[model samples]
Target: MKIINYREVPILRQSESPAAGKIWSAEGSISQRRHRQTRNGDIDMAVGDSLSMDEYKLTLASPAKVVPLDPNLVLPKPTPDIETAKADLKRAGYAILTDVFPEELVRTARQVLADEIKREEAIDESRVAKFFVDPDAKNRRLNRLPDRHEVFRQVLEHPVVLELTKHILGPTVLDESYLVHSVDANVTRPGSGAQFIHLDASNGVGHATPNQSRFIWCLDEFAEENGATRVVPGSHLWNPEIDPTGATTYESVPAEAPAGSLIIYTDMLLHGTGANISENRERASINFGITTPWCRPSINFPLVLDPEVMKNTSQTLRQLLGYSSVMNGGDYPWESAPESIRSLCVPAKMAY
Candidate 1:
């Protein structure tokens, strides 16, 4: 089996990135092993060539089909007390918890981002668009936040966040195995434009399993006038016949929340970023993409994690990062564990 390295992933495809483990690659009837032994699947987003590239551009194309905001949908409903928010997620596809974090934490995250930007500016490549895979769409964003700072480390398993993930992400193909797809940030500039409402599932186009979920940590208050996120409350439950193209004509409501609030939504839920209309203010938020045990994260943790960081990180975080799995996402039972991950997880003695 070949071991896959996550850190040095080359720029191969914008939509399709091979998963972390043993995978199937069909190129002209020839079957080849993609990795030694992790997980397997294929997700491609660019459905068309250069001229017909219209898959990931599902943003509002018609100005008349503008998005409207509902106070209930946008307001930070507050969590731990999530019954109301839970109902909203069930009915509206998203729920927001206002002021869920301490002001200090929020400030620290922003500071971390600012420091990164300063470092990038030193190299004269700090343009927001630079972070996007598509260089054409230059906006303020970061791809791999976990790789850069530990400030985000705690959020990896924030109690409320974990509960939300377990409630939605649930069990994967494997019994109790789940994994993180990615942990990134969306730091938008004043003039940043909105994106097409989309799902966080594979980059592929089509109806996907409701296995992915996104948690947005709003570092800045999301106002109606500014770029608050847009969502179709009940769109997560929409029939596949509605729009197979992944395009959306459904009107969206804004998710207005406090700076320290958290916005959690399912992957099947239709959502997108709103344009930062504030004249001079920037919208700063960190996003965590939690996926099933079988998917590949945009930024592979095993490869990007600093040795020192890994040494000090909690077992919970380490498991989410993929070091705790024996085979392809813990396919083997706990009793039949592999020694490779013994260091990552406390193996139960032939038991649960």
Candidate 2:
């Protein structure tokens, strides 16, 4: 296990000998480190003698012990593999998974989004308009997608998504596991302004570790002119004290890709929606994400999901929706009074 100095640990010199104060040159000869200290009068030596007995009083204090890094604070490095996506994630905190979604699926999903948007606008223009308003007109956002359509469920259970999600967040439920955070979509229309840069990680400043990650499934081609996502490269590894939102110094580049590509990124990486200056192009993407089982999901799926949608949903999908299994503690215990939802749960085991 890697160890790091805790906040309370004081910085101390390594040794307390005459040689410890000396700077060693590449040739193994002493430089002028000790000489500089003597000249500054920072160190004073005291000597005592009693009946021919001699003693020396040291100035430097003993070295402090290093604290083992808190497990919660430790951000696990991606396991190196033949896949370029994993390598990209380790290097830049984000990766583009090419051709993950098929052309047919993308078309169908896009149609569904268009229909949903029309229905939402018809129902309540004010509410729908407010969601689309990222301080601009024509742009919009769709929320609570799992209950709305089956294609989203298929997107949620994609083998690639499950594999990489497990790769980023550990497979085990003890420290990490995949739990659906939220399923939403963004529609950036022409003339829309850029959204503010932000971090998706909960309490990102204090708890800098990555507990969440996202998969942005593009429904349409993302281009710089049509408001593709702008990401700050290598920003995930930055210190928590550095706030990228208000700071104008950080450089963020557009993550442009084709219609079917997947933009996978850790929640800690700084990112924002780019402005759409194009004449007619409208950029659309399904923003889906998973958080560690211990973290509270952004959407309470059990409450919001329609009963009919859960009827044919897969056990894994149900589990992702906060049913079954045990980690820090099981989400919904099977031993409870309800028998209809028993199929949603698995044999539970506590993380000890």
Candidate 3:
């Protein structure tokens, strides 16, 4: 058996020998035999190894077992009531809740991002430059590229948000969605024009469907001068082909929510970020999506979470990422767990 450490592998205790205690190191790695003996008359064979000992006293330990420190971590306080938010969701395409997250969390997250940007900047300037400015001037709207930012993870798992999402999308709703892009002005250059008005799920495999929703969190203050997101309220009821201009007189309202405020909406809503005409300051917003089991996510979450992160994530988050099942859906498409869960389970099958 492959062992991560000596503790993981069983050891034979010297006192357990029924005959004259014969000390033979399985690998001769430990020179001290006295240290290897236990008070009980039994061999401490490493896990997966067999040893003759008092059946009652011998303990079996599996390295794979994980014990979490806190299983029921309460969610951070919410700024807006969930019922009110749900009501808004039905009335308008989106609803904004102000000051939902703790200010400290936002400040710390910003610091973490700034440090990461600085480090990445030192490594490659040109590569990081693309993260800020639009490649095509015509499509000048800043796109915040999301790739497992620490703050993003924190925001995604926040309890209040998750609870609200569950209430709106149904109890089975998971945080399958994540930040597709994070647009920041400091990184974005001037003349970054408005993005083409579009729906969040236009490219989604399940478009105009009932099982999807997006939850956008404003990490920084979003304002009219700083390229706040513009939206057409009640546009979710319209068909996809509807033109932006001729459409039911859209309103380009500034999404000026304070930091930690969240904007929850249906993916079908027509919205676009306004141009960042500001000279120095940049607007930063984190966009995350949540959906029912039947829909495909905007960003492939299972692919991004590394093994370590996956192991550390909450069961709720795992289910949200399509790592678990809801009842026995069998082998139907969208019925089974996502490919990420299949990959994680393969090693377990091999072990048996």
lDDT of each: 0.58, 0.63, 0.47
Residue 226, model 2: Cα distance from true site in angstroms: 0.1
Q: For candidate 3, lDDT tens digit of each residue in 16-110?
A: 47675675333333333212333432222221112322211132322233211122322122237777767666666677876677888777765
The sequence of per-residue lDDT tens digits that candidate 2 reaches over residues 219-239 is 888887898887666767774
Error of 2 at 329 (Å): 5.1
Which 10-residue window of candidate 3 scores lowest in summed lDDT? Answer: 1-10
**Candidate 1: where are CA atoms >4 Å away?**
1-80, 124-128, 131-138, 172-175, 203-209, 242-248, 326-352
How many residue-pair clashes does candidate 2 contain?
Answer: 1
Clashes of 1: 9
TM-score-sorted candidate list, best first: 2, 1, 3
Cα distance off (Å), candidate 3, residue 325: 5.7
Give one digit per residue, the lDDT tens place, for model 1 in 1-352. 1111111111122244466555322222111211111143211121111212222332212222222334354433556457777777877778887656788988999899878866766766655454533312435666556667877888876777777777776654445445678877776677655554555655433454576778999988887556777666666666353343422244555677878888988777666676566788777788887776667666666666665556777766766766655344343333454333334453211111
Residue 6's lDDT in candidate 2: 10
Q: RMSD in angstroms, all models?
A: 12.9, 18.2, 26.4
Error of 1 at 330 (Å): 4.4
